[model samples]
Target chain A: MAEALNKAGSYFIGLVRVIVMRILIAEDDLDSQTLLKVILQKEGHEIVTADNGLAAWEKFQQEDIHLLITDWVMPEMSGLDLCKKIRAQKTSEAVYIIMVTAKEEKQDLITAIDAGANDYITKPYDKGELIARVRSGERMVSLEQELINKNKEIYSEKEKSEQLLLSIFPRFIVERLKQGEVVADSCPDVTVLFADINNFANIFSRKEPVELVEILGQLFSVFDRLVSAHGLEKIKTIGDTYMAVGGIRKIRRL
Target chain B: MDSNEKEKIVVSVDPDFEEIIPGFLEHRREDIKKILEALDGNDFEGIRIIGHTMKGVGGGYGFDAISDIGRFIEAAAKENRPEDIRQHTEELASYIDRVEVVYE
Candidate 1:
C-alpha cells in the first residue's frame, strides 16, 4: 500500500510537470534554425524561429517565451545585446537563455555569462550536448517557477497561522506575543463577566454525549458573537462557563 | 562546368527541413548579395556582420563549408583584409549556389 501511494504521488508530480514551454530560437542561418527547431520540437517544446536578434526580441514581447536559444551574431542585434535587454525587463518570471555560438574564445564565453545567459553551447555542437544544455535551461526555468509557487504557499500558510493566532488572543496581545513581550497587565476600568449554563448536569444525563456537545457548541458560539459585537474580549470558555471582560482600559478612569 | 552540372552539391537534412530550407536559401542569397555590395564599398563592418552570423549558424544546418568561410571572413574583416574578405565571400557564394538540400 505504501509503495502504491508513493507511485501515485510521483505520477501526480509527473502530471504537473507536463508544462510545455514556448522556446524561441534566434539564429540567422537556415541550417541552424531548422536544426534547433527539429531537435527541440522532438523534445515536445513549441519552437518559434527568428532570423535575427531584433526579430527574436519582438517575438519575446508578443509571446510568452519561457526559454531562448540564441546565436551570438546577427544583423540588427547580437545575442549578448538581446540577453541584456531581456534581463533589464521587469518581468515576474525569469526567461532562461542559452547562448549557442561558434566563438570559442574564453573572453566571449565570459561576455555571454556577464550578459545574463543562463547557460552556453558552443558551435559544431553535438546533438546530445545541445539537448542536454536545453534540458539544463528547462530545469532552471522550472526550478524558479517551483520557488515562486513555494513562496506563495508559504505566504498563505503564514496568513492562516496568523488567523489561528487571532482566534485565540486579542490583536494587541497577539502582536505583543509576536514581539516576545509578556502580557500580564492590571486594568482598573475592566468589567469581568462570567456565566454558566444552568441545570447542566440534568441536561447532560438526558442527552447523548454528541448531542450535548453540539448544543454546548451552538450556545457558546452565540455568546462569543454577542461578546464580540459589544467590543468585549472573551477570556475563555470552561466547559459550561463563558468568561468575558469589557471596558478593558490600560489607564484608570479620571 | 555548365549551369546544370554546377548545381550538384546535395546536402541531406532532417524531414522538417522542407519547411525551412526554402526561406533559408533565400536568406543566404540575400547575404551573398549584401557581402558583394559591402565588398564594393569597402565596408569591413558589413562584411564582419555577415561573417559572424554565418560562423554562428552554418554548421548546425550541415554546411560546415559556409562556417569555415565565415570564420575566415570574420578574421579577415577584423584585420581589414579586403582581398581575403572578397575571396571568402566568393567561396561562400559558390557553396550556396551549388548546394542542394535533400530532406530525409
Candidate 2:
C-alpha cells in the first residue's frame, strides 16, 4: 500500500511538472526542418515551424516563444536580420536564440554574436551537440524564470516585514530606525496626553482574569485607533494607563 | 555503379539521413539546374541566391563538398566573376552526380 501511495504521489507531481517549452524553427529546407522538428519533439518541446525568417518573426510575435533555432539564409530575410528584430522587440521575457548555419568562419561567428544570437551552431551539426546546445538554452531560460520568481518572493517578504514593523512603531520612527539613526528627540512645542481606565480594581474584582484581560484589550484597541485618528504618536501602554504625544522637535546646534 | 565513382561521393551521417537523403539529392539536382540557367542568363544575383541556399542546406545533410562549392559560387557571384562561378557550378554538379549516402 505504501509503495502504491508513493507511485500515485509521484504521478501527481509529474502531472504538475508539465513545462513543455515552445520552440520556433526557421529553416527554408524541408529536410532540415523535419530533422530539427523530429529531434526537438523527441525531447518533449512543442515545435512551431516557419519556412523563412519573415515567417519566423511573424510566429514569434504571435506566440510566447521560449527558444529559436534559425538557419542563416532564407528567401525574404536572413537569420541575422531576424535575430536583430527579435532582440529589438520590447518583450517581457528573454527569448533564447541559436543561429544554425554552414558558415564556420570566425568573422561569421562574430557577426552572429553581434547581431544578438545567444549561441551558434555550424552545419553539418552533430545531433548530440545540437541537443546539448539546446538543452543549455533551456537551462538558461528556466534560470531566468526562476530568478524572476525569487525576486517576486523577496518583494512579498519585504512587504510582510514592513507591515509587521509598522504595527510595532509609527512610520517616521520606523524609517529613522531603518536608517540606523538615534531616535532621541526633545520637542519644544507639543501636547502630551495620558489616560487611565477608572475603577480598574473594582472591574477586575468582579470579573474572571481572562474576561478582565479581554475587556482591557478591547478598550485599549479603541484608544489606539483614537490616538491615530487624532494624529498623535502612541508612546506606551502601561497596564490601564495610555500615553501619547503630538510634537514638533527642533535639533539643537552644537 | 563503379566502385571508384561510389567512393568519390560519400555521405557519412546518422540513421536519420536515410529518411531525408533521396529528397535532399533531388533538391540538389534542382539547384544545379537553376544554377546553370542563372549562369547562361548572366544573372549573378540569381546565382548568388541559389549558392547561398546550397551553402546553408548542403552540409546540414552531410554534403560538406556541396557547401564548399556553394560558398565558392556565392563569393564568385558577389564579385561578378562568371568564369569562377561557372567553374564552381561544374564542380558542384559533378559532386552531386557522384554522391552516395551511407548511414551510420
Candidate 3:
C-alpha cells in the first residue's frame, strides 16, 4: 500500500513538472487554423492561433513562442509583414518562422525570403508533408538554437582564454602575434618600464581585502590611462607590478 | 488557392492582430506544459537547465512573459530550495496561463 501510494504520488508530481515548448500559429484561414491546432495538439504541442498577420504579431509579442507557423496572406497584415516586424525588433532573438502560402511564384519566394521567413511551404500541403515540414522545422530550429548556444559559449570561452593569455604575456607580444609578428625578428633599442607599487604588502595587510582590491583597481586604471596617453605599449601586470615598453618611435628620452 | 482572390491581394502596412492570437496562445500552452512536467518530476536539475536555456531564447522570439517566468524558475532552482522549487513551478504555470501576448 505504501509503495503504491508513493508511486502514485510520484507520478502525480511528475505530471506537474512537464516542460512544454510554446508554438505560435498565424493563419487567416479558419480551416487551416483548425487543422493546425488539431495537428499540433495530436503531437502533444500546445498551439496559439492568429487569424491575421497583425494578430499573429500581437500574439508573438505577448506569448512565449518557440516556433511560428504562419500563412502568407490574410486581412490587415501578411506573414511577410509579420516576419519583417519580428526581425526588426532591436533585441530580437531568432524566431523560427515558416511561411505557408498558396502563392509560389519565384517572386513570391524572393519576397518571403527578404522578409525573413525561415522556410516556405505551399498550401494544399500533404498531411505527411506538413508534419515532416514541422518536424524539419523543429529539427532545424533545435539545431540552429544549438549552434547559437554553442557559438555564444565558444565566444565567451575565447574571450576568457584571451584574458588568461593576456595575463600571462605582454599585450604587445600578444598583439604582434595576433597581427602575425614573429619572435625571431627583434626591434632595436626597445625601452621597457617596470613599475611596482610601493610597500604593497604593508598597505595590503593594513586594509580590508575589498579596499585592497579597489585600490589596486584604481591604480591599474591610472596606469592604463597613462600608458595610452603616452602612446606606450602595456606588456603585462605581475602582482602589484605593471610593465610597459616604448621607444619604437625614435624618442631620445625614456 | 482562389485565382479571383489572388488578383485583389495587395499587402497592407498595418497587419491584422486578431487572426494570430489564438494560435499564439495555443502554442504557449504547449510549451509551458512541457516545462512544468520537467519541473514536477523533481527534475530541478532539468528545470534549471531547460529554464535557463529558454530564458536566453524567449526574448528573441517575443515571448517576454515566458522568459520572465523562466528567469524566476532558474533563480529558484539555482538556490536549491525544495519549497521554492515547488513554488516557482506553480508560478510558472500560472504565468503561462494568464500571459497576454501583444504586438506594438
Candidate 4:
C-alpha cells in the first residue's frame, strides 16, 4: 500500500478506491493490443503497449510497470524470452507477468512458467477472466511491493538502533553488544578526568532547546577530539559535564 | 456454402466497448483486403499475422466466429493451403458483413 502511493499510484472511485495499475501489453497484433487496452482502460487502468517482445522489454526498462500482459509468440523476441529476461534481472520489486497464449498453446504454459510468467490467460480471452487474472496480478504486485517496503523499514530501524547503541558505548562494546554479548569490562590503573562547561545553566535558560543541543554537540565534538589526541577514551557525557579515562589499554601517567 | 444467411448475426457486446466497436469492426474489414493482397503475393506470413491478430481479439469483443475464422486462416496459411486460406478469408468477409453489434 505504501509502495503503491510511492509509485504514481492507486485510485479512489466514488467513496472507495481501487489500485489502478500501470499495465504493459506486449502483443504483435494491433487488434489484440488495442482491444486489451480498451478493456483494461475501461477499468480505470493506465495502459501502454509494445508491438512485440523486444519493444516491450525496452518499455519495461524505461518505466516502472506494475503488471505486464504479453502474447506468447511474436516477431523480434518471443514472450517466453521476454519473461526470462525480466525474471533474470534483479529488480528491487516484482512486476507480475501474465502470458497470453493461443488455446492450442495451453500445453506450453509449463514452458511459460519456467520462463517466469506469474499467470496465464488464453487467447480469445473471456473479459471476466482477463480482468480477474489482471486483478490477481495486481494483488501479487502490491503484496511483493509491500514486503519490499517492510524489509526496508526493518533495515532502517535496525540502523537507528545501532546508531543509538554506538553513541552510548565504545566501539568494541557496541560490536560485542551487536553480537548478543552481555559485556563487562575491567579497567584499573587509569587516570580519570571530568570537566564541566561554565555558565551552562545560563546558556540553557537563554537559548532554545535546538540551539542548546547544537552548542553542546559542537563543544562535545571538540572535547572528543582532544581526549583522543591525549590518548584517553571518552567514558560518557552528563548534561554539560565531560568524562574520559586514560590508559584503558594499560597504565599511563596523568 | 457462403450465401445462406437471411438471419441477422447480432453480437451482444458490453456497453463499455460501445465506443471502439465501430473502429474495431472496421479494422477487421480492412483485414479482408489485406488478406486478399497477401494471398495474391503468396505473403503467407503477412496473412498469418492478420489471422493471428483476429484470432486473438475477435471473441473478446463478442465475435467468436471471427476468431475461429482467424485461427483457420492462420493455420491454413502456415501449412501453404491456399484454398483453405481463401475459404476462411471469405468466411471472415461474410461474418463481418452479416454481423450486427448491440451494446448491452
Residues B18-84, candidate 3, lDDT per residue (tens digit)? 3544564465456466656766676677667545644533433345555566577777777766576
Q: Write the per-residue lDDT of candidate 2 for residues A1-254, one digit (tens) a residue.
A: 12323311111244553245689999997867987887788777779999999999999999889899999888799999999999888876757999998777999999999999999998767678889999899888877766776888899998998887776666777777777888787676898888897887886787888987788789989988998798778767777888888763222221
Residue pairs with backbone overlap in model 2: none
Instruction: Give the Å shift of residue A156 in candidate 2.
Output: 2.3
Task: Quote the lDDT for A213 in model 3.
Answer: 78
Query: Which is the leading candidate under TM-score?
Result: 4
Q: Could you give the DockQ of candidate 4?
A: 0.66
- Better by lDDT, candidate 3 or 2: 2
- In order, candidate lDDTs are 0.81, 0.80, 0.66, 0.84
Docking class of 3: incorrect
User: For model 3, what is the C-alpha lDDT against the true structure?
Assistant: 0.66
Query: What docking grade does candidate 1 earn?
Result: acceptable
Candidate 1 residue spans exceeding 4 A from truth: A1-17, A26-35, A48-64, A71-94, A124-126, A179-189, A194-254, B1-12, B100-104
Index of the highest-DockQ prediction: 4
What lDDT tens digits, residue by residue, belong to model 4 across residues A74-151? 889999999999999999967999999775554687888889999888888999999899888888887887799899
Cα miss at A47, model 1 (Å)? 3.3
Error of 1 at A175 (Å): 2.7
Q: lDDT per residue, candidate 3, A1-254, as tens digits?
A: 12323311111244542223467888765545766666666665668898898998899889867679887766799788899989898632446778876564789988998998878876545456667777777666656556776888899998898788787665555666666756454558788999997887886787888888788889989998998899887777877898988865432121
User: For each candidate, what is chain B's TM-score?
Assistant: 0.88, 0.88, 0.55, 0.92
Better of 1 and 3 by TM-score: 1
For each prediction in turn, the share of the native Cα contacts (below 8 Å between chains A and B) that it retains comes to 0.49, 0.31, 0.00, 0.71
